[model samples]
Target: MARKIGLYGILAYVVYGLFFYWYLFYFADSSLQFEYEGSKADPATFLNGRELMLTEEYSKIRNLLFFLSTPFEWLFYLFILLLGFGNAFKKWAENSSKFKFVRTAIYLFWLSLFAFIATTPLNYISYSLSKSYNISTQSFSSWMKDELIDFWINFGMMIIIVAVLYWLINKSRKRWWLYAWLLSVPFTLFMMFLQPVVIDPLYNDFYPLKNKELETKILNLADKAGIPAEHVFEVNMAEKTNALNAYVNGIGSNSRIVLWDTTLNRLSDDQILFIMAHEMAHYVEKHIYFGIAGYLLLSLVGLYLTAKLMEYVIGKWGNALRIPAVNDIRSLPLFLMILSMLLFISSPLSNFVSRYQESRADHYAIEMTQNTEAAIGTFQELTRAGLSQVNPPLLVKIFRYGHPTMLERISMLEDYEINNKAKTNE
Candidate 1:
């Protein structure tokens, strides 16, 4: 078992290295090495009513708060380490032996509640900071309602997953990881399909964009990109957030290009078109399907590593932790801890792939729109409005940033402009 674990670890490491090299060297824009001319002398000159100082301060503080919150988030694992989760799970298991499914559901409820309570303070603090910074517009009560809804949704999902996972573990202790990984693929896809329709509407109202003219413009861009323009939808997000954002989500019948009302209100038609083009590029380039494939691949590797690590930990410390076997519900915390740690360590690789995909979308956006000015302005406005860090530290970028730094994105646009001009001259 140890030999197999070591062999799997080595193979995973080598695969990750190759993937890293490919994404960094081939997939990503190597031209990210351009000179940034720095922020415009007058932020208002680029966009009306923009203040650089205030925006920069907001960006810095928002980023700092997020960075500091990481360790606080990790405290849940610490609670688990101290046998808090194990004891709760054991107690729940003892009390609800009448029905296996009901017992699992109760265990899940307790576990989810434990995590929610453990993390709520930090979550509230983050929310408060966002509100203070004018990023959040939702009132406290509304926000709490959303949080509770989210908790229950997650709890509902976890109960079924826990039941399935433990069943697999009991049936085939040695091959449970393989079965679990396979199960995750369909479950993830189903959730993705449901999220845009069933889940998202729980929090906010989505409508066919109210701006008919802008909708026409975006649909035209979508048509140019050879994607279904009818899939474009707008979320009534201004009631909850002042942040400007848009994204393409889901796959097949569930797929949609969603723009925030805040985004439509704040950005110009050209800028909105640029953003729509970026989102369209995700589908036009088949990134939605490709992303799911990448996720499944990583899950396969992660689950295998998790199973190996969980076995070793149980063998060594089961007596002390009171964890009898992998199938035992009380051992969930330890299993989760190992999986979380592995995923954390592997995040750089994941982030690299994500950054590469985003860069491709950026490239497609530029090509599809042929409006470098709008692309540049969109980033500048988003940086100011979203309080996004234009330049983050190297380690932070590798581990945390799913997209390139705002500065890196701006630099890529500049590179695109220069190349486009040279091509025109030729």
Candidate 2:
């Protein structure tokens, strides 16, 4: 009877997870629905037939590359298994046992190095493809240097995190997940605070936006939107990529609006204002803090699930994997595997929240700009420049897209235009 109850509990948990995924995918925000039927013209009317075909082809290539990369990603999980089962990490850990935490840190460094080496080929292939498609202009050597820099930075941070996590785990066996989550709060915030200022400069050049006329217009828009930003930045993205983009980055005093040179080059002044307004909307709506909160909550849930799942898996395969305890350094692979699985399962929920936030920002942009034509034109230019799909498959939207489909965004603008015209007539 006890065994049957345990099995039932597992079944119930599985059902609950499935239900959560379904809810997030389909019913998370009924408010996002559009009232007006879409325009008679197709969304792809913005693109010529050749551009449309190229857009589709680019999307297909990306999807195929993603599909191919899945096996490589799964191979990473298998590699982790080998690290744990083959006692490679354990042996490394034992090699420096005379020092207190040195052995564990060394083991972590080795683990991080192995992961970087294993993943570099896929990263290289992605870069190669981007270059082939004329999306990236960064040279191979520059890309390699950037990747190595990224590796060292991430590896250093991971060592510190793993050390702190193990200290917490050793301190409390049952409540380690809670402690780890608490510890992550400050680390997450610090990273966000640091990335824009300290980290971004390692790769690209940013200058105070040089187009004085456009800069004046953007600051005026920022003031109108109550953003208080003084200067807009233009990143030298032309040297790196052909894709157009812009964003708001950092927090508090460090916060600034950054436009890719590609965006400034491709989009007109009015359209640029619309895009800046969109990014500014993120600040006014407090999306950054809300995003952090959402991620923290998700991480908490993922961690809790990982703890529960870890106990079960370890019970079954602890000896086979040479993983003695949750707190042990040798168990890092299993810990990572469980965390990855939980995050993967919960991704739709995360993306749903992001899409809603982005949709809100879109509405805010249109309202602030009050220029429906420029708003529509901006997305049209983005679709053409980036070769983005106007309407992706439903699963892609749910699982991968952090914003609404391009067609949906365009249709919402079309509805806004129709409704405003109706209001004017009334």
TM-scores of the candidates are: 0.86, 0.87
Clashing pairs in 1: none
lDDT (tens digit, per residue) of candidate 1 on 1-426 = 434443554565556555544443345431223334334312444544445555555655554555445444444554564545667676777697888888888877777788888878878988988898888999999999999999999888888888999999999999999999988988998999999999999998888878888888888887777887584688999989988999988777888889998998889999998888888888887888888898899889999998998899888866655677878888777676677777777889989998998999998888888898988888888877776556655655887799987776877888888898999999
lDDT of 2 by residue, 230-280 (tens): 988989988788898999988888887999999989889999999988999
- Number of clashes in every candidate structure? 0, 0
Candidate 2 has an lDDT of 0.78
Worst 10-residue stretch by lDDT in candidate 1? 29-38
Candidate 2 accuracy as TM-score: 0.87
Best by lDDT: 2
- Candidate 1 stretches with Cα past 4 Å from truth are 1-35, 38-61, 64-74, 422-426
Model 1 alpha-carbon miss at residue 368, Å: 1.4
Off by over 4 Å in 2: 1-44, 67-71, 83-86
